[model samples]
Target: MKKSVTILFAFIISQFQAQPGNYYQQSAKYKMNIDVDAEKFTYQGEQTLEYTNNSPDELKVVYFHLYWNAFKPNSMMDQRVSGQGKNGDSRLQKDGVSRLASIPKNEEGSQNIHWIKQNGKELKFEIQETIMKVYLAESIKPNSTTTFTMDWDAVIPQQIRRSGRNNREGVDMTMTQWYPKIAEYDYDGWATFDYIGREFHAPFADFEVAIKINKDYVIGAGGILENPQGVKGYESKPLLSIDKNNKVTWRWTAKNILDFAWSADKDYKVKSFDVPEGPKVFLVYQQNNKTKAWEEAQPYVTKYFQIMNSHFGKYIYPTYTFIQGGDGGMEYGMCTMILGEAQNIKDLMGLMAHEGAHSWYQQMLATNESMRPWMDEGFTSYAEGYTMHQLFPEDLPNPFIKTLDSYRAFIKKGIEEPAVWLGDHHDNGSAYTYASYVKGELYLVQLGYIMGEQKLAEVLKQYYDQWSMRHPSDRDFLHIAQKVSGMDLKWFHNYWINTTKTIDYGIKDIKYDTKSTTIILINKGQVPMPIDFSVMTTDKKIITYQIPLNMTHTWKDKDMYGDFSTMPYWPWTQKEYTLTIPYTKSQLYVLGIDFSQRIADINMSDNFIEVK
Candidate 1:
């Protein structure tokens, strides 16, 4: 009986360590054929969607995102940007006027769907700017597969946002979100969001795409190019083309990806190099004097992939491209669109590191950006900081000082919103960035403070390993963290993500007798956390102590800085913690709280005291 009970306990522990299997996310398969007129800045497309309904409930309706429609004059995305006024995204504004509204009507973006069919039966559909809602001809049954086919064409708008033609950097076409992408439907039902201005979310799928365009242009995309011999720099020699219009049809295929985006340029110079133990790194940009930095950025970006592959889990994609395009830098599935005219290597490589790190959190982990952007953007930002820490030398106490700096600056305004707010529903753009990127990165650093830094590292590896292809929400990640740390972190998640509560722990008072020194730690902020403080004695010995939160039910076995003694648990209800050190007043030099600066304490003035 004893052996049987032990086996049962081991089984329970193994279940928590393994990937739990109830998230039945629907999957999609895409087959698209696109023909483009480079001069007209337009394209015609035929798309076939093979969708599987994995849910228990039958689907009555479905939707797709015509993302390019957001670039129209009076579209929902334009209105959302125009409404921000003074706080609008600077990229979408020029001297406070909406660039989207100023686009020429002929040059404006439009997607006119010719027809749609469900399983060879005609289905009714309505286009409301960027979102397409389709009334199903027949209710899709649970655990069933269905096919939807559509024919559409669009006049690509002049560059205003992520997907457009002829961006500010002189790239010919930054083609992203230029297709009729099907909306993701998971346990939360239809994630049919209006194109308001952030990123997107989609399920993993296979793509077989063929783009026909003028032979003069060079193309780069997320998928592996099938017939690349004739395309510019993709293969060693040119292959014969049978078309009479001086056009080449670039065939490409990608397996198990979320989205497909591509770019075409008349002067695009493509360089393909293999990262040792990483993906085949491709640097696609227009070579000019201004793009000298693009060449220098290769080694730095190569090292980033190696570091991420070693530090995090292996990068799932076989090829990763750093293509030159977009307003600034935007991350896609296996490639990133970055502006190419930068003159310096540091700035250019810095941009690539941040966007490239998105492969892990944004593309692979595949969180819904609209709902749980913190898990995507914030996690990517953390990976970026680590990459920069490796690629360049930062003379700081820790790698997260920039995030801490941003967090410190943003908290002072008191205009911060709860991170739980949806990506597009922020009070302003700056607030969204702070809440998503800054606060999100700070979440990991603070977790290192709560859970040991070693444990946080363990959590990252396990998270990437288990949730790479799965659409993990905040709860799913927290579950992995709890399993790794052996602690309940709901209180930590509640305060940091669910509320605008700040953290400010301080050394309130200190006193000493002949045998021991008494120190009082006070929690001035609403959010309470496990404390790691240090004391430098007059005897010149630096001593540290860690006080675990009562809710944690366990303490960190090691510390990042040095060795520390485990003190009693600080109950969340208690505002003050008294610590006694076996040192006299004459032997103490100074007492400080969280001297390593890992915690995001809003105030630092009272965290230290000179023990005279």
Candidate 2:
């Protein structure tokens, strides 16, 4: 019987290891074809994709994104356009042209052609969708390869957001997202969506892109240059071709990348540094407006790159560029577009640190930004806070230590809102950004406190390794957290992500018996954050206990499980907790719940109890 049980256990372990969702077990591959022209600052290209369907079921359709459409007039994205100002009118008045309104509407299209093989005969299929589609492509066999061709065109928008055309005198025009690209389709089906001034999730693929530009222009893209010997303005030369009009053509090939972007300029100042055992760091900023501050900022940005690479996984790309453009700091694969202005050294470092960290969440992990914006944006925001706390400890705000102050400030002004709202559905224009960015970071900080920092970091690394270049829902995150913490956290999730409840627990009553001392603690708020309770005896000895509760998703009662023999660790909840101290009635004591105010307890009036 023992021998049979051992054999069965081995079989089950092997089966578990063979599951398709195990990203670490299998290698994901992609290939792309891109061609660009610098004269008109636009791109027309074909992407040949070969995806390995590792899943169990057959996939019938694929999705592609036309993100430039978000900049169109009368679009949903057009409603929230503004410039640097406190009020909407000030932003409008400062810049007569609404950035969204300035996007060129005439140049965006994509078509997918399917390959068919029947009875030794080869055929092709074509289908096109304005936004996205479910086409009848050949069923991709399990653990096999299916190849398709996509042709697209993108007219570069005038530098608005991160991806666009930037025309500078004596400088080469920098163009990005100058072509339509296919979106990702997996267990969740099509993931095509318009750009909504938020995060981005792209499908992983290899890229072989060639651009034609003037001979004087120098181009940089997501990958290394294949053939630099080709003459300007020709298509039939070699691997990839360029055209005349002094336009330089660039051909790029990338492997295991989700998206592609490139920049070009005749006068671009290119600088490179080797990162030990990692990708090379490149700085591509124009020298026209460069200053001493700018020169000093580059090293700071590079330091952040080192910090992020060490904390997260290795930087996978061969090179990363810090290009100057757009309104502020934004991230592209293997490159970041940053605005060239900062008030002080701290401000400059902060911007660089935040943007560089995006490479981990937005680029490396590549979570879908449309549906689960919180995963990329919120997670990155949390990382930003963490990085800031580590790098600029004196200047940055400590979310864990100042949770109460944050809650009080938000509540006292009556600006408190449910943190569960959709990323694009907030009433005010900036509210969504603030909540998703700041509040989301706070949530992670609080989670770190609940489940020790080391455990939280482990879970984060696990999450990135598992879901990189894949789509994971909100539930997936909670599931991973539960597995990492070894505790069921459904109640925590429901309260934190699904409701607007606040946390307010305090001492309700105190009494002493001749044999022992007893105190009653009451939860005063609807929200149920884990609690910490501390009490002092008349002799000045302190005691602490942690109380676990069921308030968010469950209503069951059970004894809390945690070591309470320590002096400073206590947990309380929405319900009352009764504590019996091992002391006599002659002793007097003072009791406090969440004495450090780290849990953001909304009310403190009931936190203290006196016993005589």
Q: Pick the candidate with the highest lDDT.
A: 1
Q: Put down candidate 1 lDDT per residue, 158-186, tens digits, no spaces.
A: 88888898888789999998989889988
Report the CA-based lDDT of candidate 1 relative to the real structure. Answer: 0.87
| Candidate 2: tens digits of C-alpha lDDT, residues 1-612 | 999999999999878866654442112343444455556555565555555666555666545456655545555555554432232222222343455555555432222233333222343433332254536446655676666555556566555455566632233444454444556655555565555555565666666665655565656556665664563212234333334554445566667665666666665566667766667766666665542355666556556667666666567778776665555677777766666555566776667666767777777777666665555666777666566666667532243455345545666555544556755455543455545665566667656656655666777877777766555666767778778877667766777656656777777777777887777877778766655566677778666665544332221122122234322223442266677777666665777775445565667777776664
Positional deviation of residue 512's Cα in model 2 after best superposition, in angstroms? 12
lDDT of each: 0.87, 0.58
Q: What would you estimate as the lDDT of candidate 2?
A: 0.58
Off by over 4 Å in 1: 1-21, 240-242, 538-540, 610-612
Q: Looking at candidate 1, what is the lDDT of residue 194?
A: 85
